[model samples]
Target: MRLFDKEKGLFISGPEKQISCASQIWMILAGVTDRETGINIIEALDHCPDAEGMSSPYMYHHRIQALIDLGLKDRAYREMHEYWGGMVNRGTDTFWELYNPQNPDESPYGGIVIHSFCHAWSCTPAYFLRKYYY
Candidate 1:
């Protein structure tokens, strides 16, 4: 699908054509097609560089939700545990606004100190786990 750019190895939104994981997640959530197609789209994400990878908990939350909707419960729970648990392993008392284990010190504002350590968006794992996994 043109929604995804195989050359760029990422999913792009219409018009602006901006590549973001959110687009893929939303399309899957909307039931774009079969589960295999959804799985392929997500697999394509692995080809993208870490800079283009999911940088926010907001996107992660949606991605996890999509996985659950696709009947990928085991993967969803595994990813939830890995992503969120990684932060916990790092000594995070609360979820951070942005997290990239590959580059833990990455910051959009040029400094890590400005990043939000306790963000509302990052707190939705509780709801997802309760409503779906638990």
Candidate 2:
């Protein structure tokens, strides 16, 4: 109840004080929300119009899992291609620790020089795609 903002139809996160993505996905995975509410929350994940979508592959992995669990695999697959595909298009041989297409060179540590372009958590699609899709 507290996590959702009914008026805006998004999580209570971002500049107005919402958390990032992980908890909500966990809630869905843990069976905390009823099916419809879980679906709505997962569908409304951007948090706010001004919010940049989640940047961490760890968080994206959680979202992907929630989508898979909720039977929203097409959306999950599209999301993977759009986000991780951008990495491929950039000629990357590995996944990144963090990426935001809006700020392609962003690094949580401060600069691109410190970024982990090959973050292990970013390899989730292999496991998920194989298990769920094939």
RMSD list, candidates in order? 2.8, 2.6
Model 2 steric clash pairs: 12-18, 13-18
TM-score of 2: 0.83
- Candidate 2 residue-wise lDDT, 12-122, digit = tens: 655666644676688888887777887887767664454445778888888888887888889899988888898899999899898887788877787888888788899
- Name the best candidate (by TM-score): 2
| Prediction 1 TM-score vs. true | 0.82
TM-score of each: 0.82, 0.83
Task: Tell me the lDDT of candidate 1.
Answer: 0.81
Q: Pick by lDDT: which candidate is best?
A: 1
CA deviation > 4 Å runs, candidate 1: 1-19, 48-51
Clashing pairs in 1: none
What's the distance in Å from true for residue 110, model 2?
A: 1.6
The CA lDDT at 126 in model 1 is 94
